[model samples]
Target chain A: MRVRVLYFGVLKELFACPSEDVEVETGCNVGALRKVFHGRMPHTAWKSMAIAVNQEYAGDEVLLHEGDEVALLPPVSGGAPGNVPWKKIILPSPRTV
Target chain B: MQIAIVREVIDAGSITAALKAGADGAVCVFDGIVRDNTRGRRTLYLDYEAYEEMALNQMRNLAEEAIAKFGVRDIAVVHRLGRLYVGESSVLIAVASAHRGAAFEACRWLIDTLKKTVPIWKKEQFEDGAVWADGEPFPEEIVRG
Candidate 1:
């Protein structure tokens, strides 16, 4: 399977390219894909990065399908007003945008 | 107007009018201007970029959530990309509601959330050089290994 991977923000700077298509085994997971990225950049900067699949943040266990869109998001720096944690600020309805 | 990631110069005046409603008594606006300095560095310009598809999605989500939570009637968020010199408006958010409280709360919430959740990144260009600034960190739960 081939997954289209994207890099944004500082991750784009680290990857040296915005996007690329990577070959992965069928049903590979995000952690496995991270391993691929880790192999490419095994320095301290690659650590603690997040991954998003199909526009939603993904956990390691989430399985990847063919042609799936994956993104590497850098460490975000913004927060809710007055240091409010984002997890506590739940939306009343998670509507599809 | 409503929600946008534009490359053109943002017209704050038009956006302010766009958020106006007859029923609303208060309209709160937050204009995130690019200053001439950051941490003592003389910033010459700034460059913003976003994860286009995901950015729009998150922006809409933030607006809808604000309306539901703060009871605001209207919200307009416009962000600029590419190179912007100092004293330029990098992002603009306007919230309108029947009362001042909701409008104020929504405006504050919108910009903070937009900075954190939306996949937007900014690079600060100084007289010496440039550096990318990652907005505040995402929640620990969302931060994957």
Candidate 2:
């Protein structure tokens, strides 16, 4: 059973070869799939990325089935008005009243 | 009238085509463009991609939510896929309502909710490197940011 993996955003540039499809063995979990994908693109950062299966977010332990639509999503810096992940957290110093 | 995801660039006319003078008293539109910089990094371009089926469903859901929450009459949302250069439109959402207040609220909610719920993600290309725009897993942080 072959699972179809879709790459998007910056992940597409990771391949460096322009190949969109990745073939994996049946019953391989998301963690294993990440390994294979990272192996292909050694220079690209694969850690701490998000993966969605069949349009729903999935964990690394999720077992993938055949024909499952998997998409690789990297950290989105800014696109919409609200979402921003890497902002510096500022803490105020304590002052004697 | 319909929710669509196309590979071509988005335009204001396409999203506002469903609006009319008498029928639609207020026309609220949200046009998302590729910004020039992110976190002080100069951006070269943006690459947008989505889960076609689910994205359309999510957009439709936003329309319904707006109608119930803000009483918007007609809504049309079109998101672009593929590469978009600087200053190019990437997402277009228009809401037609009987009143201006509802139209404004509905439009704002639609775009805000769409960012959280939609499966679309954008990759920002910069001179030094590129990064996915807020692609984290946690919804709380992403929503607050």
Candidate 3:
């Protein structure tokens, strides 16, 4: 089986590409696929990364299928720190009042 | 709820105005912009990228969850990709609700959760060099062994 693997964030720099098609043995799960990359990069690099199958987060036990879109997601940093308040505030709900 | 991942600049004012409803008492907006500096280094620009399809999916899920969890009436989340100069709006999140509390809570929660879960990455181009910004660690449940 083959899967279209995607690299995001630093993984793109590490892998030197945005995406690629990888050949994996049939019935291989996400864990097995991760080991393939583990051989390339240091073990610490894999510690915080997450895998997404078909755009949804998947566990290691999740089996991969042919042509599945697997994404290597590094810790995400999306939003900017606006002037919004950082302190957690819990206001009384109108209903509760 | 309106959730989108756009390449063009995000228009925060218009999106916030569009989300307002007669029944809503408040609309909280979080407009995330590119800062001019990181630490002491001067930032030239920022290049943001994402797994588009997956990002959209994750954003939509967050919007829906915010509505249910915080009782926000509606939400519009738009994140821009490609190169963005300093002070440019990189992402916009607006939450509408009948009460101000819900709107405020939802708006904050949406941005916080999106930063952690969304498959978006930012590369900072400093005046001296360029590097990928370190991302916050993923939630434990999302990390695969």
Identify the superior model by lDDT, candidate 1 or candidate 2. Answer: 1
What would the per-residue lDDT of candidate 2 be over residues A33-87, giving only the tens digit for each residue? 8777666653434544667778766777788987888877554332342336532
lDDT of 1 by residue, A1-97 (tens): 8999998766676667999999999979998998888877635446457788999988888999999999987655321112322121122332221
Against the native complex, each candidate's DockQ, computed on alpha carbons, is 0.22, 0.14, 0.29
Report model 1's TM-score to 2 decimal places. Answer: 0.86
Deviating ranges (above 4 Å) for candidate 3: A81-97
Q: B1-145, model 2: which lDDT tens digit per residue?
A: 6577888766688558756457677898888887787667777777677766767876887788788888778887888887788888777788898888989998888777777667787766667655556544535422211
lDDT of each structure? 0.76, 0.67, 0.83
Q: Residue B85 lDDT in model 1?
A: 77
| Model 3: residue B26 alpha-carbon error in angstroms | 0.4
| Candidate 3: tens digits of C-alpha lDDT, residues B1-145 | 8899888989898999999999999999999999888666687887899989989999999998999999878899999999899899999999999999999988888888998889888777765556666566789899858
Residue B102 displacement in candidate 1 (angstroms): 1.0
- Please report how far candidate 3 places residue B122 from its true position, in Å: 0.6
Preferred candidate (TM-score higher): 1 or 3: 3
Q: Looking at candidate 1, what is the lDDT of residue B112?
A: 79
Sort by lDDT, best first: what order?
3, 1, 2
